[model samples]
Target chain A: MSVELDIILSFKDKMFRLAHRITGSYEDAKDIVQESLIRLWKMADKIDKYANPEALAITITKNLSLDWIKSKNNRINKMQIEEYENVLVSKEFSPEKSIEINQLHEMILKLIDSLPAQQKIIFQLRDIEGLTNKEIAEILKVNENIVKINLSRARKKIRELLTKIYNYYEN
Target chain B: MKIEELIEKYFEAETTPEEENILKEYFTSANYDKKLEIYRQYFIFLNSERNIVPGNFLPASILNENSKSKTSFNILSYKWLAIAASFLIIFIIAFTYFKSNVNNAAIVITNENFNEFKDLGTEVTFDAFFKISEYMEYVKSSINDIQAVNETFQILQTYNLMNYQ
Candidate 1:
């Protein structure tokens, strides 16, 4: 396969996974990935314009996911929300394990969601995507310092929420 | 740096990527503090978060469709050709309408007695012209009356000044 084809094949899964996690729905993630792929294909002539293809693809997926969320807000049912929360929580603990793990997962997700949109995106890119701050800064089109600040704020918020949950469980 | 200083630096975003790795390593190691166990769990959650992509069938379908459409069109450039043809038709229609309007306007200007030849009855023209003139004269008279009122007020003020003197 050509370099372009290889890159597409290699990154497709990672891009879709990131989109799925951010969107919290398989259908939305599929749409986001398709949209991102289309965009990448259309801009294939200018492939060199991006410093990092993965970062570019992730940014595209993030934007497409956000647009999907905004457009489908009213259509999102409670069952779907519960299912997505289940997916994230299910990863760490099985149903047989203590419910505390599941509860902790849900609480952490809630805390992450409560963060400002920039901070949330930064957190997802840095921690969940395992991207360097510099890569995130380039993808987000912001200064490196801004990415760092948002990541810090996101981590701090999650830590505080976990502490609160721990205290509650202790009592 | 002290552990507290490191923790503060972490939150303030002053830590380097290497420093961040150190923090993560610190959290996961046996040297971890009890109060900071929650932090450790959070980091583990973040680090272990996996990406889940959909199966190959989806992109394959897209690729198949793209190839099928390409085969159907003898020239891939036909799409743009069709768009150009559509725009050409629209342009022709617009040009015809514009030319016709211009011709109509010119005919209207050239025919000096065109209005007279029109089927409007004498009474309609007489009523329209006379009513419009009457309305204009009414407005003119109202303005003259206001001017006269102002002149009389000025004369009265002059008379009062003479009496005071």
Candidate 2:
């Protein structure tokens, strides 16, 4: 394949992960990736007009993912928040000290999902996607400081809640 | 410096992504410190999530469409270039014709007597000189017509003399 196609394919999973994090639906994320690829393909000849094609692809995926959310008028439902809060403070410390690591991982994932949209996406880009603050800022069209601050907030919240869950088990 | 210190720095949101990657590697390794076990699952989850690729995506269709559009763009550009070249050629030919006409309009009369008239300063002299030149052209054409008629008369006289003989 051509160099442009190679570059685009290299970032396919990155775009997919970003979309999946933002929209929280595998199907919507896949659609967003498809749309992004089509757009990049159309501009393939002029792709160099973008200083960073990977960033351009991510920005398009982010915008389309947000559009999907806005069109559906959906936020993380109240039930999910209640579930998250209950998980954080539940007093059911089974003395059976052998809790599965997978369960803890699921709990952390839910806690991440419970964060505000901006903080959650910032955290996702930084931690799970392994992107730099500047890269996330460019993709989200925000200042680097804003990305850093939001990421800090996200990490603090998740760490605090996870600590609470661990404390409950300890007690 | 220590892994525990780095983990604390990470929670405080003071660690760079490179440092975080180190933490990730340490936690996901088989021999992470038992004291750091609390953060192990989170790191493993992040690693797993990062590894999650979308299923079976083939962009052959997109590449095909892209190639088609590229071909059409080249053709359109070539067509526009041809039109531009044709217009440039026409403009050059018309400009040369107009420039030659301007040069002919400014031709200087070259008679020796006219040199004396050149000292008669002011634009009026040049205007009068041009008028004189036009009149001279008319006189010259008239003389040529008279010469042609005289030749015809001579021929008629020769024929009359022959009949008399």
lDDT of 2 at A37: 90
Per-candidate count of clashing residue pairs (backbone under 3 Å)? 0, 0
- For candidate 1 chain B, the 10 contiguous residues with the lowest summed lDDT are B103-112
- TM-scores for the candidates: 0.57, 0.65
**lDDT of candidate model 1 versus the reference:** 0.70
Question: Candidate 2: where are CA atoms >4 Å away?
Answer: A75-82, A88-97, B59-165
Q: Lowest summed lDDT over 10 consecutive residues: which window, candidate 2 chain B?
A: B113-122
- Which lDDT tens digits does candidate 1 get at residues B1-165? 766677778777677777777877888689888877667777666655553447873465557656676565756578879889999999999999999897566323236775774655466678898999999999899999999999999999999999998
Global Cα RMSD, each model = 25.3, 14.4
Q: iRMS of each prediction in angstroms?
A: 3.2, 2.4
Error of 1 at A12 (Å): 3.0
Residue A150 displacement (Å), model 2: 0.5
List, residue by residue over A10-126, the lDDT tens digit for candidate 1.
677777766665666777788788778877766666776667778777778878877776777623322333344454445644455444654566667756655666786888776
lDDT of 1 at B138: 96
